[model samples]
Target: MDLWVAGVDGCKAGWIAVFRNLKDPAATRLHVFAEFPDLLKFDPPAQVIAVDMPIGLPERVGAGGRAPEKSVRPLLGQRQSSVFSVPSRAAVYTEDYRDACEISLKTSEPPRKISKQAFYLFPKIREIDAVMHPDMESRVFEVHPELAFWRLNGEAEMSLPKKIKGRANAPGLNQRRDLLVSYGFDQAFLDQKPPRGAGRDDLLDAAANSLIAGRIQFGEAEPFPKSFTRDVRGLRIAIWA
Candidate 1:
């Protein structure tokens, strides 16, 4: 009985889908959240939780300047802050939490009461925080050294265009997102659905990135950041086991 947990981060809320047994497509659960409670109820055994968010920041965020090289801005335009700079493209859609951060600048818009930070990372931070709770902590980090590697080295595999880096993933972009979602399913069940569109597709891509991280941590693949740890914008998964 393998367990796979997948999540998609939308503008205002997120949609989480859980699948068991890669062989059985029908055995899946999808949860939509407007708030944090939606993620609380179930605690499956031996599950891999994948998330989309920046897990680390530039050295400026901390006292010591010990961030990794990969997270550093390119040498050409290095002055920009290394902290997860909000994607300007995502700002156009005011509904997405990522876009909500930039919503305050519109001259015609009236000031909203929500905190911008909360607009982006609220219940998410809470959900992760809850994992630290005594009851849930054991279920999460007991046997996850791979995830520990991610915390120590936080950069997406697709740091730059594949052309520049000369690194590309298999199944290509066409089925990448679906493959990611499918990763959450048990090894027996596999899916190859193509992403429907550009926007939601990004969500799927993020999910896949989480899956990639999980694979590395689980010893299914080689672990990256061989020598040191750096931070990037994404979720953090930690397990002691």
Candidate 2:
């Protein structure tokens, strides 16, 4: 049986997904979706999906971000900053940045404020939140690309970043690409221009995530926090890599 799986990442268009067959690494599809749910409707159906987005949002956050973020940060070392703090559900749902920060301060312990960068992700976060149901947790999972790369690099942090100074760095990207190539992905395919609305790095990120999806399917991938936690909505609040 050829089961399909997807690795998804948020992109300018909405989401960039790399769907691959568990049995055939060469059989893959790269696409940019207009919405998160559209990935759900993918052809041949993705039995497993690992996405680079926050899954569970707590009503009150502690000193670090979610347990998952805190749990995985130590593993990434200098690369840890790639993991952003996910605020409370109330803050995420709030419209204005100022109002959101106000709500977050009240909801979080030690009074954390939302960063503009994290605040900007609210729309995409809400997009996934609105459509996510607890039942889908069986197939859908949360992932972090940098964390995935860390695991790929023998549990060590990547010396190069995918970007530097807001610009794509070839050496950093090729370092990641080399890792995926070692895992059996074709370099040329990964090197191809990403579909409109997504960057090449987005393509590579999605590809890394797809490999994790396969691991999750085979019970090979491990969850951060080493334990599962759920939110008010019953969504699991953990990052898998």
Candidate 3:
């Protein structure tokens, strides 16, 4: 079996992943896994897995949250808000939101409050951070769908929001689909509705990240922080596009 490349995004239910055999772009596949470990069960396994989630976290709060997030925020401009401040490892390990916030406040140098949004994603963040080993850095990487789309759109931030309420055919959705189509994604696949738990944007985001994964596998992608820092566990915290 040919090794495949995968892009993953966290969803309400679990994770939505887009997999493609680089040798045959037309053979793209979508899958939903209940846990991060489930994603590693593919037959040949994905040689390159680009996921849109915070991987490496700081032991204590720094001037800016994570180095990778800081570098990409400016590039995103209008969409910078999409990048949430990642809590420290201590905060992520906390069981409750209040506890998480308290841990963040104590761990941060200047002290910071952990957003509910960031706290909600703690489980997913912890999931990756737990399994990611130093040896897997070459194959598994961090990526942001918005940044990937920005690069796909010639380095310009997308003008339209990804999710539009009460409108099935949003322009932003079409724009993303069109961009992916240009990169050899099948229109049929882009048009496919996500399963019960996943949303349309989740699929689109995964697809975009998958393209980034392909680029990375082929040596065509760039990392946000030219010089990245690793956590105490030896996990590199950098976003690629």
Candidate number with the higher TM-score (1 or 2): 2
**Can you write out model 2's per-residue Cα lDDT over 105-201, one digit (the tens) per residue?**
9999989999998998999999999999999998999999999998888989999988888899999999999999998898888999888899989
TM-score quality measure for candidate 2: 0.97
Candidate number achieving the greatest lDDT relative to the actual structure: 2
| lDDT measured at residue 154 in model 2 versus the true structure, 0 to 100 | 91
CA lDDT, every model vs. true structure = 0.35, 0.92, 0.89
The numbered model that scores best in TM-score is 2
Candidate 1 weakest lDDT stretch, 10 residues: 137-146
lDDT of 1 by residue, 152-175 (tens): 234223222212232333343334
Question: Who is ahead in lDDT, 2 or 3?
Answer: 2
Error of 1 at 126 (Å): 4.8
> What's the CA error at residue 162 for candidate 3, in Å?
1.2
lDDT of 1 at 60: 29
Task: List the candidates ranked by TM-score, beginning with the highest.
Answer: 2, 3, 1
Candidate 2 — which residues are off by over 4 angstroms? none
Across residues 1-241, which tens digit of lDDT does each residue of candidate 3 receive?
5759999999988999999998787899999999998997766689999999988888997766888888999998887888887878999999798988888999887899888778888899999988999898898899999999999999999988775443444788888999999999999998897977998889999999999999999999988798988899988878999
Q: Which RMSD does model 1 reach against the true structure?
A: 10.6
TM-scores of the candidates in the order shown:
0.41, 0.97, 0.95
RMSD, one per candidate, in order: 10.6, 0.9, 1.8
